[model samples]
Target: MKFSYLGDDAEEVSDVLTRCIGPVRVQKPLNTALSYRYEFIAAGRVAFSRATSQGSLSIGQKGEVPKLLVLLPLHGAARVRIGRDDSLISIPGKAAILDGNRLSELQIEEARSHLSFVIDQGEIFRHLSAALERPVHGSIDFTPELDLTTGAGEILFKLSQIMATCLGDNAEIQELPSTLSHLSEGIVNLLVDTVPHRFSAALTEGEWLPSPRHVKRAVDFMHANLSAPISMTDIAEAAGIGVRSLQEGFKRFKGASPISYLAQLRMEAAHRDLLNADQRLSVAEIARKWGFRHMGRFANDYRKSYGCPPSEARRRLPLSDA
Candidate 1:
């Protein structure tokens, strides 16, 4: 969708911005004539908009935001405050991306013109979760002040301009669903990959360094002591390393946690025993023998890894089918 609004009333501009962005209050200098030119272009969860105001204004909210907003000043300058601690000044080529859930304050001291990107927070999180291959909880916070002078920030700025220009009024891309979907995914993935956060660490590319000697020791210990109970700290200490080092090494070398790697070993051993067991042995017994404390969860993970629940696997004929 593409649209534009030109108005002189501050109240109407305030209402429009609130509806377009989020719940916000706008206060303009008294008796100053409001010259506003607002443009909007939207595709799916992504929207490109630019608003210019001749009247000095203060725009803010008392509560947390519901979506992510990337605000770039094409002209004019402003100071922004996030919650109560972080604050910054933004000008041309310097953008502020508000994806964090917090009260925000933006004071436009002089006549200002800016482009804004309104992205669905849920869509961003879903992309991040998919990239990490894990469930992402809590808010993914980025550096509030984004320096668009170089690197990823510059790319994001240019991409936004292209999206805004392409989807402007009279463009046919609004009718092209596949192209719009690709654009939306590109924008969201850009933010997810470029923005630093807790979840992004897992998605970061690292060099293929050889596994340190400790990793082999840890795996050997796990295999030799599969039936015995052990903790990550215990395994780390036995491998002659700290718990954190072992964790990072395992995540890098093994692509799994030490604890999770132990689970795989236990499950594999249990699978072999189940295949060779006599009729008197039960699936639950085999799982317990491998130190699997929770049969239900173990069954679920086993199903995911082996294509069947342990019980069903045990009941099947032992003859080779392949």
Candidate 2:
């Protein structure tokens, strides 16, 4: 998977990392910090972050949509706060889940390190609902006392292995979706089997929410034709829904507008090509290939979204691949 840094200073990077992984130890009290790195895994739908701090750090606020933020501490203990609740979660193999749509804060003292993985909550829930005999609902808390031993541990371990391998190999970013989906399915199955009782009542309530198959199909179509001049109408027609309905459906199901989602998907595709293309394609060529005609506008949007110039993204591609 391709990696990109969003901040220029070490402190800024630490702050982003803290938000991403909760809290971690910091060594020095300096204003300038390293930039945060975002590993574009699973076609950019999922990402993994590694944060290190010499001193103390903290994270505040919630994400725009619901996501699964999983933290695996690599060093020193840190304090995590969700709303009014707080806990001292320690390091090495310890994990915690925080809801993406809630107000939460995290504070890490000096000298801490951690890894965080972001997953789509809705996707996980849908998979869980299918695996279990009944529907699954409600939020999940990742308390330290909760043991992942019953198959869950194995699944987590496997996921961690996959993440490590992907990062270590500098894997192609395009392969992320399938890779992540495979891992997600395994984890969902484990969760269903181990946390079955926790969701029984919600299942009884008939709140089983299955993502429409069309959404996946739409995603596939968008990915396949990302370089083409596709529009909302095309997507809607492909999904067999009217434009308005399609927009609404995407918002409700995917937590993003259709265009925004398409942009993100296209950007991921372009980024992958930029990183792995053998010909060392020009930025204009890449942008045009990805259906971006206006160089200036594309460059601006790219920087805003990915926090780097398109040229930088292209430069990051493996030299051998280029």
Candidate 3:
């Protein structure tokens, strides 16, 4: 889930960049020595990367970019053009949102370093559809420019920083698909709610509330299949309703999406197992028994919910069990 590349050969750098990012041509300044470094980490549907180099470079898109990409410069400015949009310059406190499926070009100056986030476009649309309680058909036209110094943008920037820092420091977290999925889902939800996009107005003007019966049914389904790989569609079918209706029912009555509710139930189940399991069961085993795939994430979530790690919970078992 992590990759690091350091080299002076522009051709080699180009090949690596193409593989990590989309199809692109990286050109070095004529007769100038180049020092290029790239570090990347991907978790679930979100990916973060850092690019640092000591020479000016011109990179041109050769094919479609399949994910929504955000570029924030740290040292030098970056000029970016996506599709036919006007070129925008990104500095330390500003960022550019590049449309997926669009050809683009980037110009980076010397001593350049920047952080980039690549989000799955399909995931974005899925979240948007759930929020609107309707099927979303096409791509969202997001404002290409984002100001990182104020308001929602600042919050987003901080969140990205925290995610990058935590994931970078604790490599084991990367292996937890569930944790990474939740993290990516948070980012998608934030973007759909706050970022200026074509669907912004529709999202704000919605007023579709499902019945309490539907919500109850969905909850029952989630409880019955707590250990199964269930989807929104499955929950909806079990509730005798549509997927969007299920989402609305949970939002209106439970104040949480169905998926979030399911996760909460699973977390509580994991907590109970941690407390009740015999000494033969390790914390990791209890976690896996309840569908938790990674110890690091399971411990973190357990601490948040019970004010202690799973190990601590096990150690506090009753004298009879001990």
Question: Per-residue lDDT tens digits of candidate 1, residues 230-280?
Answer: 999889988999999999988876677999878877876887777678869
Q: What is the TM-score of each candidate against the true structure?
A: 0.62, 0.49, 0.63
What tens digits encode model 2's per-residue C-alpha lDDT throughout 1-322?
3454444454555454444433323233466343333433332335565655555556555333345666767677877776666555655665666665455666766667666666655455566445432223345443433333335654675566567566544455336566655665655555445543445444445434554766656777787887788888898888887888877766656557788778766776676677677665788898888888789998887765444577876644221121
Q: Write the per-residue lDDT of candidate 3 for residues 1-322, one digit (tens) a residue.
A: 6778989988888897777666678998799888998878776667778888888888887765436888877788778877785788878888788875667888877688888888766567668656754334345778888888998778778767756663455566666778767777777787778889987876666433443677768877888999988898999999999988878777765557888778777886876677676779887777887788977987887665444566766655331121
Worst 10 residues of 1 by lDDT: 313-322
Best TM-score among the predictions, by candidate number = 3
Candidate order by TM-score, decreasing, is 3, 1, 2
Which residue pairs collide, candidate 1? none
Q: Is candidate 2 or candidate 3 better by lDDT?
A: 3
Q: Which lDDT values do the candidates have, in the order given?
A: 0.74, 0.58, 0.74
Off by over 4 Å in 1: 205-322
lDDT of 1 at 68: 81
Looking at candidate 2, what is the lDDT of residue 11? Answer: 51
Q: How many backbone clashes does candidate 1 have?
A: 0
